[model samples]
Target: MNPIDTLNLDFRALSTFLAVLDEGSVSRAAVRLGVTQSAVSHTLERLRQALGDPLFVKSGRGIVPTRYALQAGPHVRQILDDLQSLSAGPPFSPATAEFTFTIAANDYQRDLLLPGLVKTLRREAPGISLQVIPSGIPSAEMLRKDACDLIVSPHAPEATDIMQRGLMADRNVVFYDPDYRKPPENLADFLKSDHISLVFGTGERPSFEISLNARGLTRRNVVTVSNFSGLPEFLRGTDMLATAPQLMSKHLLRDFAWVPLPFELKPFTLLMLWHRRNQNDPAHKWLRNQVNAVAAAMNKLNP
Candidate 1:
């Protein structure tokens, strides 16, 4: 398109483009924008003419964005964000503003970090609600798909669209019930006992287990559970030891004793990850700050 044509293009068409991309259908975009299907179609036509591309094309049963559309989306979202900030309203008040925030957390981190976060939110941001989903391996695609507002986990996602900050670093520890057995004093004792392993994903090994295997060492994994919360049940009344992050202290109240792992293992760093789209959102920023503060306090206690 010519400079004149570009200048004449309605900025509203970008909103239509974004809505259509987000909703994946013209009719849905119209509903989200409180407009008619014809209006959305008209906007798309104008955008196709101005931008010299189909922008969106019919797929099997729905429309898929063209390469150009996908490429332009982040910039378009940022443009709209800048415009909204230009006409910014009164400062954000969490106490009065109601929002449903979603986060992806591993069971251990969820148990460790969320209690403090929820406590603060209840007293301060009473109107806000939190939704927590299980965190497997966090990915950039997960963020782009709006899978969660933030991800709290040890593995950093390798997507350019996602940004992350280190929350804490944790080492492995042996957890065992005193009634059933004592803490392992060395690697030989640790290897002799049966073990419970927390498997975050199917067919995947835990870091501590992998580390042990790297040194030609292996333990008898008698019980395998998906989350740290389930470790106690499997370890109780048995001579099984579970090696997990130190953060488990915040979540576990069972009559369990813990000691540092007898074998050398690398520590894992927990991270807070979010999409760039929500990076500048005031409410998102505030929530991130609050969570970061919570992480800092927890790190001090655990570290």
Candidate 2:
């Protein structure tokens, strides 16, 4: 058969074709589309004439799509989805939105910030859902591929497709148990004190220790842990000092005393990252607003 001009095709014929393929019969397709069976048959006939192929073939008790229809199913579905997105105008109402919002976050940021987000979701977005997944350097790929709605980390993504904004920044300080250790007031005291070293991701040494090692600085690492939350448990009632961001240390300040580090270290900034595709989505906008509000509250207390 010769190729027909697609410009002459009516858009309704595509919808009708999909409806028949889904329902498997003109009668059922008519009911599903709230149209008369004759109207459905007429639409199918027009599709057959335009495409020059029988989209479906009758079987024993139902219809089966031809190879052409089977191949076109995915493209048709994508077109339909794009059209629906373009025409979608419902206002994003968080209170009534029953959606699962997934995010990629490491244990440190997850523990520190998500609890507050969960509380806010419960109070303001009663029907919303949350899922927190472990994150790494490749989290930017996950965002671009739509694996998660957002990612939070101290490190920013290198991918240009991913956009990140600083949620908060904090300085590093020494936290030590008062019962067994005095706050390090000078460089000599800091180097002599036993310390807890935290190792995360692919780094051989933590950033604070890395900066120290660059200038021939060193500290006695008596204990090593992968997570920041465990520092309090390991250092409680002991003289070991651990370096942590000021924001992280705030929660443990009651159990441990934090004093300014003797050496200068760059302040770490926590960032929230998302794909550019979601920048204008109303639902995503609302979700960002909610998270920003939570961060603002945290900033107030830490400040």
Candidate 3:
């Protein structure tokens, strides 16, 4: 029989095939899909018969996709994504909707936007809950893999399928405790003082740090925390300084004092990102509008 004529797979089989291809094991794919190993095996058998290829082959103790499966993966994924977009069928009413939206964001963006978002949801859509996850240098795959519905960050990963909008812009400022030390008045004073900085898990340096290093300006970094939330504890009682976005002073670092950086640095804009598939969905569009409104209000308040 012709392979095209034999193809009679349903959405479930296609989904299971992609799951196994991604997890590289029937057992692991079963766990991901919340099905038994035998069920996953049965689905794969159907997919193999339909496609006229053994999609996965045992490689050592694990499994790997064959060339045909590898070639078919993107097409299958696009098909599923298109089908998902179709599920957003009826006009969405926030007041009656009941679903959880998972968003990927770091502490800085989380503290800056989520609280306001929570309030808006409570007032407008009480049934819709939110799940916030850490966004480590936002990637398009996070959306494609269904890892998150949205991502808020300063960095937007380059991808044709990902869409982004600028939320707010803030200049870098020096954060310190007034009781512990006075603000540095000059570049020499700024560089001489010990510093506390954020170093993310990805080991990517912030733009200001990269620019500073390129200019041959180095501060004495006495402490490096993994996230912005960890900065205040290390800085509260010491003479150390941290360079962070000025907008943080209103929320996460509200108790602390912040001053203009001794040296000039360009402002960074926070961006909200989502997959293009979600761009036209009414519910997703509503959430994006709320985030945009919150960012606008924050900009007005700070300006």
Candidate 4:
């Protein structure tokens, strides 16, 4: 297609094309675009003509993009995003802006960070809203796809497209019910006892287990639980001992007796992660700063 002809395509046509590609059906795209299916069809026709390609073809009750459309989708999305950013003015204005940000973090993070963040938001950017979700181990693909606005993970994923900033370093501690009698005197003895492990994506907990092995011990019989918040309850009145981040244990298991890990495991660094797409977004930058501030405050309180 001629460059001038491509320049003549309207934003509506590009938007329709993107919606169809995203939704895989005209009806669904119409619903997302808040228009009739016929309108979406008409817009698709326009896009097809402007691009000088069929763009998409019907396949098995749905539409599949032609190779040309497949190649164009990302470019179109990027262009649209750039245009939207240009029209929206600055990425952030503390005094007069409304933004809903979604973050993925674990229970420990919520306990340690949310209170300070809430206070900061109220004082600085009251118009912004936050939604916190439990984060798992870092996945670069998820970040790139914008599945999450921000991810607070124990360690940063090795992805060039993602930006990572260290938030805080937290120690890990071992905990058992206060009333329980048996306390392991050493790493070898600790290995003999049943263990309750908090597991996340791709078995990240084993890194800590390896530290134990290095000390001439390993967790033999283990029970895995999904959420860190539930570990205390699971350990209460049970013989199983659990290992968790010290900051989280201090906040959640205040009433429960806890002790340091029998073996020395390296302190885990909490980090903030975001996609390259938000690199220059003013609001995103502000939110990242708020998160870092919260982490810093928590570190001081704990230290």
Which structure is stronger by lDDT: 1 or 3? 3
**How many residue pairs clash in model 1?**
0
Error of 1 at 77 (Å): 9.1
Displacement of the residue 33 alpha carbon in candidate 1, Å: 17
Q: lDDT of each prediction vs. the true structure?
A: 0.82, 0.79, 0.88, 0.76
Number of colliding residue pairs in each model? 0, 0, 0, 0
Clash list (residue pairs), candidate 3: none
Model 2 residue runs over 4 Å out of place are 1-89
TM-score rank order:
1, 3, 2, 4
Q: Would you estimate the TM-scores of all the predictions?
A: 0.73, 0.69, 0.73, 0.67
The alpha-carbon lDDT assigned to residue 254 of candidate 1 equals 44
Give RMSD (Å) of candidate 1 vs. truth: 5.9
lDDT of 4 by residue, 1-303 (tens): 563465446678777888788667899778766789999988777677766789989889877999999898879878876876777675468877787888878777777777788788888888978888767776765665566899887757775447889988888877777587467778776777888886665556646766765766667556787777777777788887887777766578775666787765778888889975586677888889989988887778777
The sequence of per-residue lDDT tens digits that candidate 2 reaches over residues 1-303 is 455664244457666777777667788778656789999888777667778788888899888899998788767756665665676589888889898999888776887788889998999898999999877654555775577999988877675346788898878888888888678879999999888998866544567888899999888888888767678888888888888877666464556778988988888888899975566678888888888888999889877
| Candidates in order: C-alpha RMSD to true structure | 5.9, 12.7, 5.6, 7.0
Tens-digit lDDT track of model 3 for 1-303? 677676666678888888787767899778767789999998888778877799899889988899999899889878877777788788899999999999999999999999999999999999999999999988767887789999999899876457899999878899999998999989999999999987898897788899899999888998999989998899999999999888889888888998898877888889999986687788999999999999999889887
Worst 10 residues of 4 by lDDT: 1-10
